[model samples]
Target: MTELGRFGVWVPHTEVTPAQAREIEELGYGALWLGASPGADLPGVAELLDATETLTVATSIVNVWATPAKQVAESFHRLESRYPGRFLLGIGAGHPEITSEYRKPYDVLVEYLDELDAAGVPRERRALAALGPRVLKLAAERTAGPLPYLVTPDHTREARPLIGPNALLAVEHKVVLDADPVRARQTARPRVEFYLDLTNYVTTLRRLGFADADLAKPGSDRLYDGLVAHGSAESVVKQLVRHIDAGADHVALQILDDDSLSTLRALAPLLREIP
Candidate 1:
C-alpha cells in the first residue's frame, strides 16, 4: 500500500528466472526493473512477472526507436488490465548516435506521450526514463515520475524540485561488493565509461558536482566512488540512504557483481537498514 518501500533491481532481460526473482523478493527489494536494451521488453516483462508472485516489473526503458507509443500504450493497457499495478511502462527517447531515427528528444517524447494519451495510456501507470531537465519536467507533468540513470544524490536533489512533490523519483546507482577501493572502482569503471560517452549522463553527473576531468574516459576513481557503491555492505547501505534522504522515492540498484542473487544476499542485512 505504501508502494512496497520503493527498492528494485535492474536485470538484463534474459538473465532473470522465477527462482532468482523469488530471491530478490525475499531479499526485500520491492520491484524488479528489466533493462530493455536488446530485446522486446513487454514480452520479457511477461516472463519476469510470471516468474514472481508480487514483484512489480518496469522497463528500465522501452526504447522509443523500437516500439511505437500508441502500440505500446495499447499493450500497456492490456497488461495493466491483466496485472493491475504490477507493471509500470517506463519509456525513453534513446540516444541519437545509436539510432538513425533519433530526432529532437523532447519533441519526440512529447509526441510519444500525446500518442499514448490518444491511445488511453493513463499517466499514472507509466514513468519516463529521464535524465535531462526538460524531459524530467515533462515526465513529472505527464507520467508517474522520473527514473534517472547513473545519477547521484546531488542530481536527485536537483530533480526532486523539478518533479515537485507528488511525482515519484527513482534514481539508479551501480554497486559492487568488493572491499578494496581500487578493485571496486575498477569494476565500476568499465560500465560507467560507456555512459560517460553519452551526453545525458555526463550532463547529469556534471550537475551532480563531478568535473569534466572526473567524467573522462575510464572515469576518475573519485567520480566512480560517488556514482557507484563499492566495498562493504555497510558502505553500500550508506550510499543508498544518501539517495533516499535526497528526496528520491526509490533507488533501483544495478549490481555490478556477476551473481545478482549473491549480491542481494550480501546486501540483505544492509538493505533492511535503508529506511
Candidate 2:
C-alpha cells in the first residue's frame, strides 16, 4: 500500500494549484484526494504530483459512467510508472439522477474493476468510492477498500467490520475551522445541502440513523454536526480523529472555507499529535 500518512486533504481538482499542492505536502498532509470526479485523463494531475515530492495524489473518484475503464487503466498505469507508489486510483459509479447512462451500478463497477485488472492496475493501487453494504463488500474483495464520502465516524465504525481489518478504510470528512458554532454550520450547510440532494448520501445518512427530517434540505443541526467537523481547530481535530478511532486508516479533510489553506495551516500542528 502507498503511504497515505494518517491525514489527507480533499478538494475539488480546480482548487489544487501546483503551488498549493507543495504547501499541503509541506504542512504534513500525507495525501491529496481530488474530488468531484476528476476524469480518466486526469487533467492537471501530473503538475500537482510534479510540484509535490511525496504527497500521494488520488482521485476521490473517476466516475465510471463518464470514463471508460480501459482509459482510466491506461492513465493509472502512466501515473504509477512515473510516480511508483505515489498515486492511488479511486473509482465510483456516480448517481443515477445525474447520469443518464447510469444503470446497474454494482454490475458496472464490477465489470470496470475487471477491465482494470485485465489492464494490470494492481488492486492495492486502487480504491472504490463505496457507501452501500454490497459495494463496500465489493471494494473489500476487489480493491483497496472503501473511500466513502459524506460519512460520519459512526459509519466508519460500522463499515470497518464489513470491510474487515486489513483493507485500507479511508473516509472523506468535511470540516469547518471556525470556532463559532453558528458560523461553522453556516459555512458547512451549503455543501451539506448539496449532498442532501444526492440519493446515495441521503440513504447512507438514513441508514446511519437519521430520519427524513434530518435528511431534509438545509439539513438538521444533528445532521450538520454528524457530517461536518466544526468549531475550533482543536474541536474539529478531535472530531476528525474519531473517524480514525472508529477504524479509518486515513481521513481526507475537505476544509469548507473560501481559503482552505488557512484551515490546513492551522490544523497542521494539531494533526502531528494524531497517531
Candidate 3:
C-alpha cells in the first residue's frame, strides 16, 4: 500500500481549480483531500488527479445517506481504473441534525462498507470519517483507517490504541497564520462555531474534556485554541507535529481562510521539515 505522506492539505473541492491543484502538488503536498459530500459521480476528484502527477486525491467524505452505496462504489472503481493508486474513497455517516434518515449510523456504515467490498473497491484505498471508538475500530477492521476531523492530539493519542498499530490514522487540524492572539481567534471562532451545532462534534469535544461552557456558541478561547493552531507557520507545524507524536500517520492541515493556495505555498518550506 502507498502510504499517505506525513503532511497533506484539505480544501473544499469547489474552491480548488485544476491550476491550484497542480500548485498544491508543486508545493510538495502528498495528498489533496477534497472536503465535499460529492454524491455518486465525483468528477472533481478525477479533475484533480488529471491535473497533477503523483498527488493523491481523497474525498474528505462522501455521505452515505445522500449517496447510494453502489453508486459510490462504482465511482470509486471508475476513478481507481484511471488514477490507479492515487484515489482514496472516503465515506462517512454524517451528522443526524442534517441527515433526516440518520438512524443507526454504525449499522448503515457497515452495510455501506459491505457494498463497497462486494463492488471490489479495495479496502486499502478506502477510509472512514470516524471520531468515536466504535466507528474508529470499524474503520480499522473494514478499511484503510479513520480520517478524523476537528480532533486534537489527545484524541489521536486515545484513538491510536483502538485502531491498533497498522491502520492509518489521518487527523485533520485547523490552522491560522497570525501572530496577534485576538486576530487569530477571530479567524478561528467562526470556523469552530460552524461545528458546534452538530451533535457529533459537540459530543467529541466533550469527550476530549471540553465542558458545556467550552462548547457554547462562539466557543471558549480554550476550545478554539485547542481545535485550531494560530500563529506563525512554525507554530502551526508544532501543533501538527503533536498529532504525529500522538500516533497519527497523516495530518491533513486545513487553513481557515478563503485563500488556501497562498497559505499552502507559504507553509510549504516549514511543512517539508517534517519527516
Candidate 4:
C-alpha cells in the first residue's frame, strides 16, 4: 500500500553512509534497501532516515533465523514513530547452509509473521523476500508483498498473478554499468556464482527453467545476462523496465559496480521515466 516511487537503490548496509543516503534522496530515488540481512536492532537505520526528509529506508531482508521477530517489531515501531511512513521492513528466511537453526523455511517464516503480528507490526509496513509461490502467496496475504531478489522479468510476469493485482511486486535486479559484454559478465560472475550455491536461489532458478549447465560454477553467459543488466546506462535501464512491463509495482536497482553512487547518478534521469 505504500507507494515506493518507480525506482529505488539496493545497496549493502556496510556501504551506505548518511551523505550517500541524502544524495540518493536528492537524486530522486524513492527508497533505499539495505541488503545483507541487517541486525534486528537496525544500527544506522535512523541516521539514514534522519538524513533524508521523505526517502524510504528498507531492509532488503532481515533474517528471521538471526533476528527475533519481536525485537524487529519493536525497532520497526521505534523508527516509524520517529519517521512515520518512511520505513519499510523486508524480512526473509535465510539459507539453511549458513543458519544452524534453519528448518522448514515456510513454517519458520509463518511463525515469524505470527510473532510480528502479535507484536503489532502493521502488515502494510512489512514485506517478504519471497521467491517461491507458497511464500509469495503468504506475502500477499499477510504483508505488503514480495521483494524478490535475483529475478528476471519473466519471473516478474509469473509472480504478479500469484500475488494478485494489488500487492506490491517490488523486484530487485542487479546492474553492471559496462558497455563491453566481456567485462560486464566478468564483473557479474562472482555475485552470480555466490548465489548459485544457495539452495533457495538454485531451486528458484531451476523452477524458472534454467538448466544445470546454466547454474553451474561460474554460470553460463545466458544465465549472467538474464540475471544482471549490463551495457550503457540507457541499455541497462531498458532491461530493468522489462520488469515493470511484466507487472512489478516497483524496481529496486542494485549496482554491481564499485562506484555505486556514480552509477546511481548516471541512471537517475533515465530511471525517472521508467514507468
Which candidate gets the maximum lDDT versus the true structure?
A: 4
Q: 1-275, model 1: which lDDT tens digit per residue?
A: 12546678887767787778878987888888878553432775666667777888778788887887766877787777777788887888877768887778888888888988898877887889888788899999999989898887888988999889989998888999889999888787777888877877777778778897897898888888888888888888888889889899888889988776788888887777666
List candidate 3 segments past 4 Å from native. none
Clashes of each: 0, 0, 0, 0
Alpha carbon lDDT at 70, candidate 2: 92
TM-score of each: 0.94, 0.98, 0.98, 0.98
The lDDT-based order of candidates, best leading, equals 4, 2, 3, 1
Colliding residue pairs in candidate 1? none
Tens digits of per-residue lDDT for model 2, 128-216: 99998999999999998899999999999999999999999999999998888888899998788988888888889999999999988
Full-model lDDT for every candidate: 0.81, 0.92, 0.88, 0.93
Worst ten-residue run, lDDT, model 4? 1-10
Candidate 4 lDDT, 1-275, residue by residue in tens: 66589999999898899999999999999999999989999989999999999899999999999999999999999998999999999999989889987789999989999999999999999999999999999999999999999979989999999999999999999999999999999998877799989999999999888999999989998899999999999999999999999999999989989898999999999898765
- The whole-model C-alpha lDDT of candidate 4 against the native structure comes to 0.93
lDDT of 3 by residue, 1-275 (tens): 54568888888778788888898889988888888687688868888889999999888988999888888888888887898899888889989999886799999999999988998888999999999999999999999999999988999999999999999999989988888878888888777798999999999999999999998899988988899988887887898899999999999988886676777888899888888
For candidate 2, the per-residue lDDT at 112 reads 93
lDDT for model 2, on a 0 to 1 scale?
A: 0.92
Q: At residue 56, what lDDT does model 3 achieve?
A: 90
Worst 10 residues of 2 by lDDT: 189-198
Give the Cα error of residue 1 in candidate 3, in Å.
Answer: 2.7
